[model samples]
Target: MSTQFGAASTTDDVLAGVDLKGRRVLVTGASAGLGVETCRALAAHGADVVGAVRNLAKGEAATAAVRAAAEASGGSFALIELDLASLASVRAATDALVASGTPFDLVIANAGVMAAPFGRTVDGFETQFGTNHLGHFVFVNRIAGLIREGGRLVNLSSAGHRFSDVDLVDPNYDTTPYDPWQAYGRSKTANVLFALEFDRRHAPRGVRATAVHPGGILETELARHLGEGEVEALVTSLDERNAAAGLPKFQLKTIPQGAATSVWAGVVASADDVGGHYCEDCHVAEVHEGESMDGVRAYALDPEKAKALWARSEELVGETF
Candidate 1:
């Protein structure tokens, strides 16, 4: 039986009585929203946290806020620079962290861009694909050595992955029409595939990985690219569908609520032996058969495809496992 919690759970609720003293954790995009909450919760539980962010100013402010929150709650925190859109930035940040020599007990790959317009990164890759997925791929491989035995890695995926997979023949829209949603979907799928492959390759060494859907929390950096109308249309559509299907209307979760599933996947006892599982609402997601548009897409879980993506990613980032 799959154990799952509902969207109502908060970070404190999920992490109740859990102690993270001496644990080292890295959370990307911790400037605001869910990332801030996750950082505060883990720090409050006694974990030493590293907030990896893009802008130094925003990062400093966010770090200050997190530290203040943690101190208010009696906890600790720090910050690091990591611009996921730039390969050079990723390398510089990785080199600094590696040099620090602090082995990470947990890594929450929580940074990502959502449905953004057509744009490329400094390395000439699609912005969404580059930052939301490729950057993380390189980041994970770079830090694979830092993860302690029994460490865990969590990738933040979304239901948006239902839109598509990596366009193997032309992943960068080099010869086709550029569709932002498709690109975002491909990136999210990559998140899942990355976790699956990472788990397969590292679980034997006592390192495990999981990908999770953090529920539809509208109040996030993920929606920064969407216009008010687009956001309203998407939100309305989902709400209407839920009503028609007799399901609960999608509600914007509090930051702590949004961070719950991630915390659960990162440290819950019930998930001790669970790796390579796509999770949501604090539990292992069921394999959906009828609709390819919902749940775990086949390509996302295909070990062969996962391996292939890893190889291509290595080539792109010039990093080898």
Candidate 2:
């Protein structure tokens, strides 16, 4: 794919001139933030979009723009109830989708919690890990067959994955102490590994999967758990770290800019270039061994680790793909 797009590219910039009239897409967390922007852009380009939300009322109220865009562009938009924090909800949603027998051109696991306080999901797993990783694991795998042969899966991972690798043995924090950021990190890393393994399993059928890190954006609902002044302090710390590494100060992206990479990988970029990889800023990220915000970590893409994670996820979810 020859292109000129980067960190600053908005969803519209990445999708300019592209028509998705016959495409069908599923975007989770569609009620707010990046998910809302992602759905709006895809619908505006003529894709039939299904926005999955934990709360239908909130989703309907939040997606007025998406619905209007779809109507104006000859595309379509609808909503589905999904709460990634609950296995029952995931099962019900996936079963209903599979029963509909409608195939999707792409499935973007764009819903997730970030740096949330310590808590357990409905199934008693750590909040971030359960909602961000395990929920998508079962949700996607169960509906894997509904993805057309050439379809793709885009898991929304994060640069925060560098905080720590998944602790499979202590995933629930039973034996290990709970730290919100570390838990979030584990879940984010699981997101990347899940995409990697899913790609390995499905690529032979022409279905591909990739993970993307939407650059930091402060205005999203994702920061709701942070206390007053925490965002400012976090930004200061990040900038100091970047400056010490001789890099420019960290800059938060707009929602459109933040969601750009998802559409780029899901629609614009070639499968061969992004399949089984971690992407950021509309391109495949390099594997960086150290702590930095610019690239993916080696451990996050380890094939063996990905496989291991897949197995453990199956065990925890009590479901096999």
Candidate 3:
């Protein structure tokens, strides 16, 4: 039970000495960045990994390293087509997964879009909400039955959740002004809430869920929408927010370091202890009040709000799971 890892931990550090010969894992957005690193680490430890990506052509090239790593550990890796921006793609991907009859030991909702200019997904919901929250909501439910009893669901959230709680009543910004950061925050909050409700409902079945705020942000694909000046402004904003939260000075993390918390939540943490918790820096993060960064907010972890959001999501997606 000792916390053997920290912000400096890597995926290999968390998985060291742990055997995953027969384990199955699925990582969303595995075409590049943290997703690629996560799969490479898992596959190197003998876990069969499926990397879900939006572009199969690009994904195949991206996952080549993972496949090579699997060879050394007697594991395997493959890419599956998945576009979170499109519900049809989600369903199609889920159908393929179910038909394959693979009992996944862990599913990491790792793909996300951040702070993009105002837009809607193909499904007509706000781009962030639709792609980051609702897309995973439907995809996970469709594959829920395939997860083994002792499996885990690792939902990748962000420190940005502190920016705003989800405006459930008008999540799509129907009447409100569209602020990109606020929308991203709302989506990240939904990620946390989803993990909360998911753990509440399924923990008894021995499948636990966790939401992770991977520390140390850097320029990643998630920043695709930011222009040159905007990126610099974001860095300054993050530092100011951390100071306001009474946290230490901020330092951007390399991809491997940033991916550590999610990897820990997915494979290293004990299911019974970590389910439904918001994690960062390889441990449970504190809930900070009146802060726009650094830790989880109370609203994101509220059970009642989680349930309400779950229901709203079901309605938005027009299906009951």
Candidate 4:
């Protein structure tokens, strides 16, 4: 089956005729933007979704919005607390979920911050690296048992991964000059590596994993770190380039469009048998070549790097699985 749904496909469109009854989906960063849309679409398709957000008030509002949308469309959703910057928070949330005795059929590592000013997480690692990569690392490991066999993990990465791979020697920025965008790139690269390694290690346990570049949805929380002018300039530059290539306008994806690849990865049977691939525009993206900003690079998908990253992550977060 072709996974190449275009920018025009809505969440409902990708999910049509796909039944998710009795399935449970856990989505982080569910307060607004694509996360809310992802949760809404999953609920609409008969999956019970848990929206995980850091702020309770915002999460409640987000949940209400999804509930309202679901009521009109016939679906269901709930909300929970999860702060990716703090290992304690990740642990507490997973503990609560375990206490509730629910096994997740899909776990979407969807919450992340981008290009924030140099800072450290509560765990003392660089904030972006800590939250974006390590947080999901520990979270998934903590709840590995609760994932149903044949379950899937969807890591929300970005094309910015083309900017740089992990600085293996100084992942925390302790030994290098900190560049915010580079740090963000490392974190995103980490996301891809995480999926690659997770699939290698856990696929045998019946847990499959994939990472996705959710197609440049501009309004997601990650954009908060960019100035308005910077955002405009970035979009404008991409637009002109796409036009020059005779491609469609480089439009910022709508929430549903942005989320299609991830939602598809979670439920697609074709994906069931294929793990460790990077996806974009709802398809397995082609590997790119020198001096271009697209597709998964070799090092980012390297099993050795993935394995090393997993080991470093265990040391960084002090968690073993």
**Candidate of highest lDDT:** 2
TM-score of 1: 0.94
The model with the greater lDDT, 3 or 4, is 3
What's the lDDT for residue 87 in model 1? 85
Model 2 / residue 42 / CA error / Å: 0.2
Instruction: Point out where model 3 deviates above 4 Å.
Output: 244-246
lDDT for every model? 0.84, 0.96, 0.89, 0.85
lDDT of 4 by residue, 81-116 (tens): 899999999999989888888899999999999889
RMSD of every candidate to native, in Å, equals 2.0, 0.7, 1.3, 2.0
Model 2 residue 101 CA deviation (Å) reads 0.2
lDDT of 2 by residue, 11-126 (tens): 99999999999999999999999999999999999999999999999999999999999999999999999999999999999999999999999999999999898899999999
Mark the regions of model 1 whose C-alpha exceeds 4 Å error after superposition: 1-4, 72-75, 240-248, 269-272, 289-294
Give me the runs in candidate 2 sitting further than 4 Å from their true place. Answer: none
TM-score of 3: 0.97
TM-score (C-alpha) between model 4 and the true structure: 0.94
Better-scoring candidate (lDDT), 2 or 3: 2
TM-scores for every predicted model: 0.94, 0.99, 0.97, 0.94
Ranking by lDDT: 2, 3, 4, 1
